[model samples]
Target chain A: MNNERILLVSRPKGTPAMSDFRYEEAAVPELKGDQVLVKTIYLSVDPYMRGRMNDTKSYVPPFELNEVISGGIVGQVVQSLSSDLAEGDFVIGNLPWQKYNVVNDISVRKLDSNIAPLSANLGVLGMTGLTAYFGLLDIGKPQEGETVVVSGAAGAVGTIVGQIAKIKGARVVGIAGSEEKTAYLKNELGFDEVINYKTDNVFEALKAACPGGVDVYFDNVGGEISDAVLRLLNHGARIPVCGQIALYNLEKMDVGPRIQSQLLINSALMKGFIVSDYAAHFEEGAMELAKWLMEGKLSYKENIVEGFENTIDAFLGLFKGENTGKQLVKVAEPENV
Target chain B: MNNERILLVSRPKGTPAMSDFRYEEAAVPELKGDQVLVKTIYLSVDPYMRGRMNDTKSYVPPFELNEVISGGIVGQVVQSLSSDLAEGDFVIGNLPWQKYNVVNDISVRKLDSNIAPLSANLGVLGMTGLTAYFGLLDIGKPQEGETVVVSGAAGAVGTIVGQIAKIKGARVVGIAGSEEKTAYLKNELGFDEVINYKTDNVFEALKAACPGGVDVYFDNVGGEISDAVLRLLNHGARIPVCGQIALYNLEKMDVGPRIQSQLLINSALMKGFIVSDYAAHFEEGAMELAKWLMEGKLSYKENIVEGFENTIDAFLGLFKGENTGKQLVKVAEPENV
Candidate 1:
């Protein structure tokens, strides 16, 4: 058997370029005890991956130089040596950007294809969904009739966040980069108001949109858009920061107006968190998300780029706001299916 | 009887000047139903008062122009017609900065002069103490073996915050503007580390002091100092912003390195709050604080200036970082005492 994997050849400077990644071919090794030979079906590309590419100390360690980049990947078990997993079973794990992965059966969890699509396990029913779930519900805690302003409102987490806030009876206001995103959020996702940050004066637009002031701000794309939303925060506002896509590619330290004073005066809360922080309650979150989806109360979209070769492009496109929702790369299909 | 009061004659542009305040004399009116004529003993002048001085909305409404300035005042009941208060009883209330005030009996709470000094009710046992108590325990939640860093270590809230952090068995590091403040925090308060922010390279000093990174940052002075503390935050660090004394006097918008990225990468929490946010739990906090003080686990200091004439000067000195602890003006000694 053969395997091809993308390696981080060099660290990115400013914006990541194609030259930073290198694809190499290798022979797939035979499976050992408890090991399963899995073929990649779909790979998730997220804004947070950009941070791991840099050699810096963060909640998660930086990806090593010349190492295979790993993220949320859903694969099918082609060969198994453990009772926990069986041949032809679809599983999801934090796996490398490779055509084939030889991992222990315990490393991947078997997925129920009947619950949702195989790819949805890597998205809406997966980490992205859980990120929005815990960040919004646990931290943001939007109350009934309160206003919720979400940045990256058309992205994977944002879309889910807006729906969840709506479910909680909050007036949803979304800020996105394009008119298409703004329209989708307002029309499809039931966002009460949408601001096109790229074209609109975000500060003015936000002020106009949130007449009662923002009670909860679900921040995914931090920067100027966040600054505008922060200024209009109501007293006792909650801000759950899940991502900072805007600052991820910057080569130098990013500077802007300090937020502490605004937070101080408003008696607001701003918390930053990764999805895995709530690993203890992931089952509870995933169950609720699945229930919402099954009931038609939740919807998710995926910008699926076909083939393994386009993975880098899919990942890089996240910074450019190319994807409306979860960005994924389809490498192969389930052999048994 | 004659009464002298200081009024906010004009709105201050940046730092408050003496001209912004005007002294007015009025006749002390006769006590009406349930009214008490209270003579001011000690009036607190806090940094947060600067925010109220501006004609801008905050947690508390801005001080109305041409109206008498008001804040935490510890006074003695000189003449009472109500059953709640009697002659010579010490009381505290949010009252006008006047030599004598005729207010409804329900407006003031009687203080137990036996439990602590009457002045302590306005400092370590009152709003200032409650601010530190709730801001630290509720928001910061400093754990044993964690590093707790507090700015404005010599000020009213900071002093109590350090003591509380120490009580929780956390390693306390204090940041203040002078050697005297640093020495006091380290030598008298038993702070594990103290950084003289004015003379030291705060970033480097803090880094050296907190080798394990900051776990709880009680931010009283926001600006470059906060930026530096924010950078060294450990994962899940909690910051309770009590005040922004450093930016209180700024004429223009203050800008610095945006903090969301750092907070995100660390999965940290930064919340801004005033003492009144925990109003419902005041008795619990005040009881615990009193217990700590009686057990000799807590100590406080007050920089009390003499006479009603210097009230404006005392308030102005807060912007200059002039007072080491709770800044107050002794309007008059208790009439009965």
Candidate 2:
């Protein structure tokens, strides 16, 4: 079968553009023992993928030019050589932005749609959900009555972070890019306060919203937003940094707010977290998030575009602040045959 | 009795000069109920005193111009008016830079010289010791088989930090000002390695020492030294900031070694801690530290200058890096009694 794939054409200079990706058609190879042929159904386009596009040293390696730009995907098994994953099985795996993938079963996990929608597994029950859950509970340690301030609150991870903080009984303040996103955080996600960062003076608004100073700061959008929150952190504040979307788009020293002195004076506890770091704790985190989600105690939304060809556009949405929640590409409907 | 005192005279414009203080003699204070007329025996010289000298907001209040500078002191009870303390009792308490003080008995804690030595109560066995213990364990949380790096390694608090990290089965590396101090950390204090910040490229030396990348960073000194260490942190690293001796004397804005971006990429944690924040857990921390002292599992040194009049010289030694361990002014010898 012919497979359509998105390959990294070049390393982005700044704000990863659609031109950096090249769409092409390739031949699907035969599955080896213990390998399953996965037909991509829902391919996730996340901000972290931007990190892999750069050759700079980080937690993970950069994606090579001319290679398929890889990421997590919810796929249907069209052919399987391994008994562990039979053909027709719906699985979630690191299947990349592709129409088809010949991958090992070990890298794939079967998801039951009856338990929750399979796509919900990609949005809230997958890495994104685990990221918010563990990062908050383990790092943020949100206690009831404490205030949690999250930047990028309208984004996928930020939305769930606010919800998780809400479930933990902490007061939540969300900072987003637009009026619409700010309203969504307050009315739909139950954030105690919402700051339209693009419109308001973030420092003054955050100070007024979290008058007592924040106990937990979940930083998704770093830079000036982080600097503003840093100034308002109470002594012994915990900052769980999961993303730095603001800095990810820098061409050269894009300066807004410098936070070094504020970091020293506030004496804030700033810790960065990658979801994979808590792999051992994922099961516990997922189960709790799943329970809260099923009970209607949690709410989530997605910005999913249709077609594999549109994967680059979905990935590029992060920098523009265009996508409200987990941005995914629904490449195809699940095939039963 | 005549009371001799050194008044603040005037707050220093920047780095304090001897001219900022003036010596004067007056009648000894008369004792009141629950009060004791104590003779200043050891006038403690510490970095935190710099905060008090400045007319600005800080953890403690600034010293008023023309008032005797307040500091931690080892004093002898000269005349007692309370049952809690008595004459000839050597104690550690807050006292002014004066020959005598009419202090409340409740304000001082009696020192048991037999536990180690009376002078140690002013250094390692006192506030500095508790600061190192609580900050490292409570905030830094060094675990076994980890690489623990401590800045200001020759200072009172930094010395204990290296030893405690060693006790926890960590490889300890310390950063100090002089070769003598560096040698003392490796040979005398038993630190695995020590870097002399005066002559070495601190960042390069740090990279060489901690090839595995730093795990627990107990920082008594902040600034570029911290910036250097921040870059070398492994994922899941912890930085417990107790003090910033380097920034204490900063005349202007820093020009180099920016660190915030490095911290974000490392997924490391940097936290600030005032020892008193964990005062509730201090009794328990002090108990363990005392055991380490008695078992010969810990070692400390002091840079003691004789005479109460020499307190300014002792304070100046901190900036000069003249003291090897805890720096103190031995105000009055017991023979005077």
Q: In order, what DockQ does each candidate have?
A: 0.88, 0.39
Q: State, as a TM-score between 0 and 1, how close model 2 is to the true structure.
A: 0.94
- Give the C-alpha miss distance for residue A32 in model 2, angstroms: 3.2
Residue A6 lDDT (model 2)? 88
What is the C-alpha lDDT profile of model 1 across A1-337, one tens digit per residue?
A: 8899999989999899999999999899988989999999999998889989888887688999999999999999988899888889999999988999999988999999999999999888999999999999999999999999999999999999999999999999999999999999999999999999989999999999999999999998888888888889999999999998889998788888899988999999999999989999999999999999999999989899999999999998999999998999999877854
Docking class of 2: acceptable
What is the number of residue pairs that collide in model 1? Answer: 0
Tell me the spans in candidate 1 whose CA falls farther than 4 Å from its real position: none
Write one digit per residue (lDDT tens) for candidate 1, span B60-129: 9999889999999999999999998999999999999899999999999999999998899999999999
RMSD of every candidate to native, in Å, equals 1.1, 2.5
- Model 2 Cα lDDT, one tens digit per residue, B228-291: 8887888778888777777666666444433445666777877776666776876787778788
lDDT of each: 0.93, 0.83
Model 2 segments more than 4 A misplaced: A251-267, B6-13, B17-27, B55-57, B61-67, B251-261, B335-337
Model 2 — interface RMS deviation? 3.4
lDDT of 2 by residue, A184-221 (tens): 99988889999999889999999899988889999887
